[model samples]
Target: MSGNRYGHSSPPMFLVDSGGGHPGEHQYYHQQVLGQGNPPLVPCWTFPPARAKMKKRGTMNNGMTWVLIMILLLVFAALGLGAYQILRLQNQVERLTQEMPAEVESITAQKQVGLPAELIKMKQIRADFIGAHLIGHADQRSSSGTLNWETQLGTAFINGIQYHNGGFQINETGYYFVYSRVEFLIYTCSHKDSHTHRVSVLRRGENRTIMEDHQEGFCKSSNNQKWMTGSHLSSLQRFQESDWLFVNVSHPLFLSKNFQNNFFGLFKI
Candidate 1:
């Protein structure tokens, strides 16, 4: 230790040897006094060269910086991909919304255009028409057994036309085609005699004589039973509202209960 003039001890100086015995080895290390007074020299620590340590630190720092930059690039790429997906979804939703109103309007227009034809087709299916059948046996010869045939079949008339007392009363005025059929049968054939069957139509009020038909049959068997049929059809005849109409047969006793053999029908034209 060396004392200065101001009476403070001076710190020792470190000395590293520049001359060496080997190629890479240090020769010696010493402490040199810098003041005018000669002092005892002290040995000091010799630091190793700084190039290798600095190079190692620089390499570590460069590796960490590249890692940080790669992480930032990955984060940015993820964000961009997410944004692209969101934009695609938004565009799809917008396209569907734009087409929805056009589809709805097209369907509505089709329904509106077809409405009148559909109504007309439905009206044609339900119209004013009627049909009936005489449903029991009757006696033509006996006056007591001959009664008005009024019992009707299932759903006899439609559109206000009704069956009452063997007559059809009309509710609407229109031209109508009328038709009727009757079956006549007899158990005993007495001789070879000609028989006459008649069916006629009459309207109640002004036009009573509308139409009539006749059927003739000759007894072919000497003692066997005989059968005949009579049918009457009228052309399109004009009728009025509340008009009553019926069928009349000369021999009602021969009428069988078979509805297929005895029927009456009318249809408005």
Candidate 2:
């Protein structure tokens, strides 16, 4: 036996001669060494426990599960928010639909109330204008140097003026356009035959002719035949309140019997 450098005695060593050694001889020698009751030395190693590895794997699986659960929760929350917005929009549409008819009716009522008032205002403006139109009648006669007129005959009317005793009574003082038409008939045409038509105004018992027409010496028919003629007079004149206007003719018997042949009218300008 030899000693090691650490001053410890080494184990016993065996040397085999290889000149004619049999394969079984080596095994025999090792069996003889182990049979001495000395077991061979082996190294021991320490590793982590199986339960610790299993626990780590289980922790990883739990973390994955929690992540999946969080994703599912977030998806459900988004769906709920979308549903709330849709419901709010639908409610707004319903409210507007309910109010539409009343709004339309209110607008229509405003138009209905406004139109008639405008029409009535226009009618009042038309009525405020002063004018009159008078026609002749067969019963009308010129006896007081002024011809009488039919106030209620065919197409005869008076406004802002009055007819009193064969004259028009002015109610408003202003400028007026006065006009008259007279037709004449003659049974015999002869020399010195004449006719005159005049439009006169009377204010404060003074009579003045504003317009006149005279026709004479035109009766060339000598065979005593009937003749027809006409005279018309018009003028712009100024008057005061309570003034009277009248029409006069030189020959009353020659006046036409046809009522349509004579007319008189005036209007404020």
Candidate 3:
């Protein structure tokens, strides 16, 4: 039947059934008449292949979206962790500072320093005398004689602008160890008419010359005597604003006998 289409010797209808040959319009058209008398329509299947492709594409897009979301979440989480770490480090530093107990003793070192109260009193007496604190103390130089006399809180009227410790004061006055180191001794007598320089000590009423007048230059020596300065050495003593320093000199430099207005004044202790 497949080779000869026009031959009279053809196969039976039941013989062609195996290959679905009805010889009419189509094999399904006979079922429409024999059974329910309706066109047996085959449902169109367009969604299967396309649905699989769409599913694969949707899966890929969802995977990429998930990856991007994960990356963003990780970045935010990392930033939050870094901020937490910074706060933790700051807390650790604060704890370390608070836990160190030995620093309390180290900060208040004045109680452990030198000079017992006795020695401080003797030095305070010396500060009351010729150690007049002057501010902007000018010596034919740039600055005038200015001193605070309250502490090493300011510069010294001494050498170049280096060490600025004038001296401290004695708050309580009692029996005190006087630490006197005779730095230098200049010996000379006043002119019979006018004035000359010399090293001597004068009591309140009695005038007495301790060292003899040497007509040469000033002599230098190391005599740790409680006798006071042979000459006026600056001892800028610091004092309070309302306190008054009682000036008493062993060798009176500013007085009626050896009087000079520029010797010592204008200080509150």
Candidate 4:
């Protein structure tokens, strides 16, 4: 121990040798003062090196970053695919829209091309029908056993048929259904009185009866009252072009004056 000028004892110095035998190894020293208790040395703890732990943390951080990057990339890829699909659909729609007018025009052109043929077919159908309906005329009387008709009176018409010389001339050759009706008025009842209606066709200056109807016994002789009767003749006949049809009745004078009661009509079948 050594005393300073202030009379305080100085600490004693002690040298400590390192265990290494290498030359010029470093030495450590500690000092302790007399009459002072030495402090207890605390045990030092050594931890593992930080480099490996830092490397593990860095590796974990890199893995997490890579995983996030991959997720982001997948999301972007999905978005890109969706955008491409939308664009493709838009293009298809635009293309179809551009072509629609041409398709419509083509359809219209086809219809236009077929229009004339359809119209011609319809005209032919209309021309194929041959029919005529002629009503009786009150002013015109029967001549040579043939009854005359009104050409332009009520409900009287001729289509594909001609009227000449008190007969209807067929303009087209086909089977025809000919019909005639005649109503008669008798002032006095007589059993012997009879009625006859006949429809005939004349072809090439030759006449042939096609339909005939007879009526009798419709009146009482004892009563001597006014009576009425009717006769209808109808038949299906084949006619050639230029053939003429005529209607004849037994009693022209006694025929009813009503146009509806006396009519001659024929229609091609």
Candidate 5:
């Protein structure tokens, strides 16, 4: 309908019909309504930029919080497992301690009942096992002097015992069976009387002899070659620690170089 505005002919504008118009038409209707002293309508719309950024930040914070919670849960789970393992080990240790005395008693009873015969025999053999067997120096020529012994295979000592300087040094103090054999031979058969041979067990700086033996060689009045052998053995005799024992012969030059025939040995009994 035609309307009069300020005494001029003009079309009437209604804000209620502005919804059917374009943006420019709607703006014109708003201006006209404002000019008519009508209170302008203030539109309410959601501002996207600020709300979008806030929403994105909130989502990021939630994700980080969830991740932190998960990490804490994992850490706590590992700590719980460690504590449980420690407690289990402690329980096992206590159980073992509670049963230890009974097990020890059973072992004691078995020991008191006595060991097997084989074990006893083995122990006796071990106790009687310590000894040294030394042979005369094979490389040296037979001479009338004190015999010097070898230390390697041709001469050997065991059980912490050793031979040095023509003597056996005792390492352990015990009853030992000592023995020696010396073989004597001479190319010249000038001696008509029984060829005398003597072997003695002597210690360092001892006036008395521990053991000795004397033997006469088997020689015919017609035959010229002479040979004699003497052997000495001492029963289980008490010996002191670090005692130096050696074989002494009256005729050292006549002693044979043969190890099998001339050897010294001792065994603990």
Candidate 6:
């Protein structure tokens, strides 16, 4: 009957020890006393410690720096590769320009044997035959049927329907120039099935293009279907050196490798 028991409502929560308990710090708890005499305690709950406060700005900056470096390296590599390719292409163009001749005089000058009158005759006949074939009136048809032979030569002419079987004969003489015409001809190295510009001298015709296709190194189309006649060797006295320029021709259109099977018809105009 001497003391009255009073209950305490509010409790104290420390800033330093805001969490439930200090590690190894006695879990002592204090609350407010209301009326005085024997005070009754209220349950106390500890607050949580402040979470780690610093922002990871430095970490983010480092990550960004690394990314930028990688990007720059990639960019530089691409630029360098592009520059190298351009230089290579330019060098290639210059080399080709220096090594090859595009003009008629430059090309013809290469031949030690000058062009004589007989070359004109050969070109004329070849042109005529080609023209006929294009018009569907073929004098000789290629294996692909692009060309056809109309007549076989008689015994007097060594060069019969097949140029390889014989040579040719010439009875006229004069200053001559050699020129070639190509139709649907492909270089062996190129393995092409299309027409290309190419020529070669049978007896050192200098102005001839070695090979229309570059890959085949030094293979030349047969000049057998060709002709050569001139006063190049025979002086003015040999008004008409009896010479025969016979050619052996084959149809490369569909690859008539057994050239003998393809008989090309040729004659003098």
TM-score of each: 0.43, 0.52, 0.28, 0.51, 0.45, 0.28
Model 4: pairs clashing at backbone N, Cα or C within 3 Å: none
- Candidate 4's TM-score reads 0.51
Runs in model 1 deviating more than 4 A are 1-124, 127-155, 190-207
Range of the 10 consecutive residues with the lowest summed lDDT in candidate 4: 103-112
Q: Which should have the higher TM-score, number 1 or number 5? A: 5
Q: For every model in order, what is the number of clashing pairs? A: 3, 0, 16, 0, 6, 20
Best by TM-score: 2
lDDT per residue, candidate 1, 209-242, as tens digits? Answer: 4666655444456565555544544455777778
Better of 1 and 5 by lDDT: 5
lDDT of 3 by residue, 55-78 (tens): 999999999999999999999999
Off by over 4 Å in 6: 1-54, 102-245, 249-269
Task: Tell me the whole-model lDDT of each prediction, alpha carbons only.
Answer: 0.53, 0.73, 0.33, 0.71, 0.60, 0.33
**What range of 10 consecutive residues in model 3 has the weakest lDDT sum?**
176-185
| Tens-digit lDDT string for candidate 6 (74-174) | 99999999999999999999998787632223323234232322233344555532101101112333442233222232111122112221222233443
The better-scoring model by lDDT among 2 and 6 is 2
Per-residue error at 228 for model 3, in Å?
A: 41
lDDT, candidate 4, residue 175?
Answer: 83
* Global Cα lDDT for candidate 5: 0.60
Q: Write the residue-wise lDDT of candidate 2 on 102-127 in tens digits.
A: 31222221132332233333335777
lDDT of 4 by residue, 58-177 (tens): 999999999999999999999999999999999999998787733122222112333223333333577665677677778556556688888777667777778986799888888876
Model 6 residue 130 CA deviation (Å) reads: 25
Give the range where candidate 1 is weakest over 10 consecutive residues by summed lDDT. 103-112
RMSD of 1: 23.9
